[model samples]
Target chain A: MTTPASSTADNHAWLRRQARWSPYELAFWLAVLIPFWVFPTYLTLASQIAITALFAVSVDLVLGYAGIVTLGHAMFFGLGAYAAGLLTKAGWGEPLSGLVLSGLLTALVGLLVSFMIVRVQHLALLMITLGLGLLTAELANSLGWLTGGTDGLQGVDVWPVFNHFEFDLWGYTAYAYALAALFVGVAAARRIVHSSFGLSLRGVRENLNRMPAIGSPWRRHLQIVYTISAGMAGIAGAVLTHTTETVSLDSLSFQRSADVVVMLILGGTGRLYGAILGAAIFMIARDQLSDMNPQYWYFWIGLLLMLVVLFMPKGILGGLSGLLRRLGG
Target chain B: MSEIMLATQSVRKSFGSLEVARDVSIELPRGARHALIGPNGAGKTTLINLITGQLAPDGGRILLEGVDITHAPVAARVRRGLTRTFQINTLFPDLTPLESVVMAICEREGKAAQFWRPLTSHGDAIDEAHEILARLRLADEATRTTRHLPYGKQRLLEIALALATKPKVLLLDEPAAGVPKDESAMLFSVIDALPEDMTILFIEHDMSIVFTFASRIIVLVAGGVLLEADPDTVRSDPRVREVYLGSAHGH
Candidate 1:
């Protein structure tokens, strides 16, 4: 029999063989890094890509890892945004503290809501989230005294980050910060989905019956994932609010949730980088198209999403990755 | 003397009007390799479910050793050393065989909820999992994804998974079902080699294999035990022949 030393060597060699990066992949990553060094208007676009990518990644935790389809995800995102906004407008406009409070407050809300949602399945889960988001939006509207409602909570001056780095109107600091957060979030997500607990979660998804047989408490497993994914969404929201320095009730809409699902599908579910690519591609297209045809952009985006669902059910990156593997690329 | 490891006292279950399990009492003494033989629609799986606390009994008591577990959930029963495998429902498709076994072992080790520490960092659990996989002769296919494994290997993985739970009372619902004849015998040998103190109850329609391996045979007719005795007596019992052995041969 071959010794352990030889086996370990073989494994390392196999991984090395697999590490050959495609030219397109190299180019894409290089472009992402370019915004970090080059000073240009690409900063705002990069910031949008980072925040949107993080939000998409959080949504994928539920959709891909735990296998729950959500249409009311904006509730957490909006909660985070407004929580930061309200605290800042309340004469406590510290960026560091506002970000922390945003995540904490949204996490508490997510915990309460997730407990009620654990028993719901499929369309009920979607509808309940939708209703929850709508209710939150309505509260924000009625209590404009707190949320600033439809006009949005504006004129909020966030103190410099760390009491030193002032909010850069040029968007450089915001883009770099957002990109770092997204990178860390995606990397952490990758670790969880690759772990044993995550594997058991997939087992729970495949067959609820199988989990108990394997000595897993299925409901508790689902609840844990829900709570963690909710917190991740909250972080994404806090990051978005931090960069924009403005909060809008638009953050809590069914469109936002549906858009994230579209992003996940556009990149591919169950893949980390796919979420990033999907969010970037989606936001870029929507922004460019809306610039040209602001009123009709929604119709075109919807048409394209349906086309993707029909023709490329795996999402763009998912399909491309599979095609590459099949062709020995 | 054989010690009683698991006992059910007139346990009853019904799905509305359908009486799937009725007034069932079972005893699996420690070290007993008990065979539950029945024809189609004989409620063998339901009996297994009741014992493992998957479906709560409508009316009777389920005692594991001296402890009453009638109201206990399936995970609780698993923790109490009662582990079971589904005939067809169990097994995760996308994970590697090693991953599935590692998850089971993690549960039995009682620390599956730990989020920050990666599972592979736990050296002892990995070693224990390796040992369990080795027992089922699946060490060679450890890294292969579950969906890629052949049907027989999947069945082996199922039993291997149950083994990883450190079960004292093992209930297998048709462990040999859907597996080919050669593979069934291989599976039988694996079960035969299990620790002698373990109490194993399994449902089987394969009478030849059942008669060859089982020391005790319990025949279930209509959600109730018709006969519970040694294999020789059960093989010759007129009622067993009439309800079970006869129908099985009709095909």
Candidate 2:
């Protein structure tokens, strides 16, 4: 019989093995970096993909891991966008600091909102989030003097990266900045999900009733995750505002929230890589399909979503992992 | 007498008009192996829920080690050395037993908020979880997903999770509800092996398991305690025989 010490060592090794990066994961990250050198012309599209991927990861933190059903995620994103825009418009134009401040501000709002959000579940939760989203959108719309309303927030200026590289017309700096933020956000999210705290969140998602018995308060866990998720999404939004130098009503639109949900579903929920892959695939498909057939592009997107749901049911990443398992077996 | 670890004084609860628990009072000293046996809807589970803070008692006081905790939340109760297992198996189906137990241990240690470190960094928690699983004869199955485990093992996992909290009082609601007869004996054997200082109140239907494992039995009928005595006394009591054991034996 193995000694207790040896068995524990085995368990430690096994846990580390589970968290270690596989070759496929490494390849995916390498591919994320490849667009900078291999496809310079697509830098603008690539940057958007990076920003959306970060946003999708934020959604997955709540929706996929915590099992919170929300339709108003864009509230934070829009908040971040406007926060960055307003900051720049007011002359605090440093890009990195602007991003950090926007994310922090969004997190504060998320913490406040989570007090109400964590109290409800299922349909009520959905409605509260939806109402919050709409409420914010209308608040921004009505505050024409501040947010510029339908005209969108204009004259927002962003400074250089650490007083070094300048924001260029070719989108070089924007792509690099957004990609760096995505990497950091994704890494932090990955760390959170694989930690003891992350496991508790999964436990909350799987059996919320059981968490209390095990000494983990379900609502507190939900609130913490929601706040963190909101902050990450806010960062993504701030990145967009910085790159594009514009903030429109679309930032907080219901459609933006709905589209992020679709992206998460397409990529898989729960898995960090799935969110990134989903965001990348969805954005690429939108860019390509809309170019090929602008008016009917959504038709193809709908078809793809249906096919993914029917065959995979777990999202593209889930499907791929299942297939790999079968082949190995 | 041993110090009282858990006590409920005149606890009462009702769903609209149907009174499920009626002015019930029960006390458990440290290390007491008490079995709560009653017929269907006799408030056995309700009493457990009331003590564990799952449902508010209509009127009464609950004390844990002499501290008033009548209105504490479920998680707070757990953190204060009170824990329970569901009658129905409630588990994280996608997580492995090791992960579930480690998370439980983390909750107990207040390390659940350690978001920056990797799970493997908690080597001590992992070791403790493995030991707990091993104690329940689940060490081999620790790495397997909880959903795919045999029904008997899943029930054991419930006890394992409770034990992870180092609970001073464990309220188990029909822990062997759906397990096969042969397996439940082993399940109780594991419970029997738990620390002797831990107080355990379990609800079980099987008389043999109850008699074999429990040092004392509390019989309830129509939301009131019929008798609270040692196994031998409870066995000979005709009222218990008539109300519960009689009908229980008939099946």
Candidate 3:
């Protein structure tokens, strides 16, 4: 009995230690800020990376943590972009409010869609999400008068952030705004994944059959995480619309959804930092490779993916952590 | 007489032509230790599933503490103080035993929806989970990933998880399945030490463990109960011997 008390305390301490941020995580966030100073000319690309990284993190919340395999995540992202773009176009162009409202709206839709998404599993779930994504893209295309279709939603007028910092051509404000959003999104996600709800999601991912017997309803947990993930993705899309002042039809396309998945796979799934790292690497590689050879960039990208998969199946971050463990031991 | 903790009245289930449960009826009083003994293909696991809401019965009622809960979901049943362990190991392989049990405790406490706070903040749940692990003699293995644990320890972890729910009625479908013979006896000793007020109904193929731990023996044959009586009576009953114990001992 004496041993039980000490052992229980040890378990509690161990869990707290695991939840604490490591030095590497702090260093990663600090490094993210360095681009604003050092890469002044490349701020536009840097902001794009930040927005995409945020999107990747949102995808990881569902696909990695909750074990939801969805191909329609970009539907919510696209919806948020359109929501923010249309709001600014119509006269309500408050940047912060627009972002919040867009995220909440997408969350509402996500909650509704999750009812259907949580009902199925495996291939059926994938098909439903993919079908919904295609349907949204087609609907946007058909409603050209409202959405501007392939010409894109032009004349999106976003006022200066906080009425103080205008979005400059140099992309200083854009990079700062996107970076702030990324930090907030990552911090919130980190909190969620280390919580009981997050642990339950992992349990659902690991063995869904065993959840109910332990008194946890699997569907409810999945639905909550899915809705939250959607909301985060929506916020990322809203950031893009605010920074770019345009909403293209490609924003809601299946390609965007697939690209986020690719980013998550490249960085590793389940871990939040992996998503951000993957996004940064993929976008950087694309920027440099496309500049070098415009028409054949895909060939290089494909080769890089193959190399990563063959050599580091768990993704670069996972591989690095494994190496670090072996070295430390 | 003690109050009935669990009862199934004329429950029926079938997989097309295969009758897994045919008008099956059984009862467990408070604190009763009952062993369900039967030959292979006797539908013991299926009966456990029917009670736990994994598979809906074709007809009849399932009552817990005199409340009919035949149509309740598995989670609802667990919340109502009824829990069960699987014949095969079903666990979170990547998670440590401590994390898994704490998550189970959080679910039991209705705190699983708390996402804003870190898991360590649930101090009560963590302590409770650790207590459960220690009670099951898994304290040393608590921090190891479940997939890396030995087969016997993994089986024990299953029972530990079930206990975290604080169930009043526990149904164990071969809780010691696939464990070594020596470990199986240790497993039963743990089961024997559970709260006296808790009801238990277990399905076991090993007669020696069954006769030692079970105050009463229930012989199920072909989706129906052939005999239900005290172990002394059950051991002497020719029908029980012919259908179950006879073959079990022969092997």
Candidate 4:
């Protein structure tokens, strides 16, 4: 908190600070939350939105902030799901223990894979991560003993909240829990982005030459952010498994990985709300389109993505922001 | 110790088959304003790269306060109080001058790159950035993006960024290059007013600007130091006259 102003004049000055949030952030969130609670179907959709938002947020932390482009983020997500699934199967089914263990297991895998991925940049990073995601799917397929292979590791029963409250399928406890968790994750990420370290990464992105001139080890900073983002992605994946007690090979698939990136771009690249906005649009479109035709649904999405990539290169929210810029100018 | 804050001794660097900076040396004492003048392919910039730790010397040593920093990485060299401006103006194109300076000062203060606390919360850093801009006569341009500024102003912003590093020594690679002819004095005044604690080594093709500012001049001809002399000797030397001014203006 800021030091309380010594005089009335100083207090007034603080009130006028530019960083103070405007009514837009307040009103926009109010609108989003009302819908989630109003519709019965929105509860399930909202929880999925929260999970996918967290996952996409993790990807953006790396892509937008850290400048590591990848399409294989599902590798971390899948690792997290398997971790939660397998721990429950092993009878460590308590909510707190299962959640903590799942995050830890996913984090461990992330640590091992990060050193290799962080060394490459641009398209090479993209290609390597794609390979890594595909390889993870194949490994999940072969590890039938642990993951139940193609059939999946089923019968995961997430132990009750604090060993007391039970999970319901309808619009109740699960959605709220995910929303609370998402708020914490997003708040922490927001804090991290405004820190001195985040400025250094922006400097790195601007010019690799400038970092050393300004006293920053570019590679080391990149590694640290990548590692953190991977762990966060892993935790998001684990949360999905906890909410829905199933882990399958599809979790590790490249298609899931690509979908998350598309969601990230759909919202906005670097904007904080981009991930949440992206995930919401992606899930709603998928749901609406699937109802129309299960097999042909993806074709419409492909068309939408093409139009957005060409005309709205900055993504949806970004395009809106650009519109504001032109009007202001 | 000759009051030299930075010294490059017989440093040599090259790219592939081209030996760009061959056995070059210079000493920048505290408060010394030195100018480097050379023809188009004279290797002045290659030598500047060696001093700034962007290029490791193929041979010889570089010392900051007599301690060898020949192999120090660029970041380490910067923390040791060295800063440089690029030949081509480089700024965060979209960021206003105030934001750019805030970033530089933050780096010097060891702030993490982007901690999510709002940028306005960095009162001290922001104030220092504003002060630097005002000192450089850039106060009016604080809110304007560097890329949108006039060419001469962009050059000053580059120097402002270097100044933000609070360097003990500054290396400027052609600060006046490509600046609009009419805007030359605006850039010159900014460079002229730099604090004396900052040892300056600037490369310039324009003799008028070089002679206008520098106390001492070092002439590089064809990838090596040809002569180090006071302005009087450098101006009168037949060799410098033949090599540089003669080539450019045909005597």
State which candidate has the highest DockQ. 3
Candidate 1, which segments miss by more than 4 Å at Cα?
A1-30, A36-39
Instruction: Go through the candidates in order and give each one's DockQ.
Output: 0.43, 0.61, 0.63, 0.42
Candidate 2 - CAPRI tier?
medium
Best by lDDT: 3
Candidate 4, superposed: residue stretches over 4 Å from native: A1-19, A35-37, A96-101, A108-112, A162-164, A325-329, B113-121
Model 2 stretches with alpha carbons more than 4 Å out: A1-6, B249-251
Model 3 RMSD, rounded to 1 decimal = 2.1
lDDT of the candidates, in the order given? 0.79, 0.91, 0.92, 0.79
Clash pairs, model 1 backbone: none
Lowest summed lDDT across 10 adjacent residues in model 4 chain B is found at B111-120
Please write out the lDDT profile of model 4 over residues A1-329, one tens digit for every residue: 23333332343344234334557657765665674557867788788888889888888888877777888989998998898887887887776666667667766777777888867878889999999999989988988988899998889978887787677878466776677667767776766666656666666666666667766667777776777777778778877887777888888889989998888777887766788888888999998899999999989878888888999988998898789768877
Residue B6 of model 4, lDDT score: 89
TM-score of chain A of 4: 0.89
Query: What would the per-residue lDDT of candidate 1 be over residues A105-152, giving only the tens digit for each residue?
Result: 776777788887778888998888778888887887899888777888
Candidate 2 interface RMSD after superposing interface residues? 3.5
- Model 2 agreement with the true structure over B122-227: per-residue lDDT tens digits: 9889999989988988888888788988888899898899989989999889998988899888788888988999999999999999999999999999899989
Model 3, range B1-251, lDDT digits (tens) per residue? Answer: 98999999999999999998988889999999999989988899999999999999999899999999999999999999999999999999999999999999999999998889899899999888888998899998888888988999999999999999999999999998988889999999999999999999999988889999999988889999898999999988888878786677654
Off by over 4 Å in 3: A1-6, B249-251
- How high is each candidate's TM-score? 0.93, 0.97, 0.97, 0.92
Q: Rank the candidates by TM-score, best first.
A: 3, 2, 1, 4
Q: Tell me how many clashing residue pairs each candidate has.
A: 0, 0, 0, 20
Query: Model 2 chain A: which ten-residue window has the lowest total lDDT?
Result: A1-10
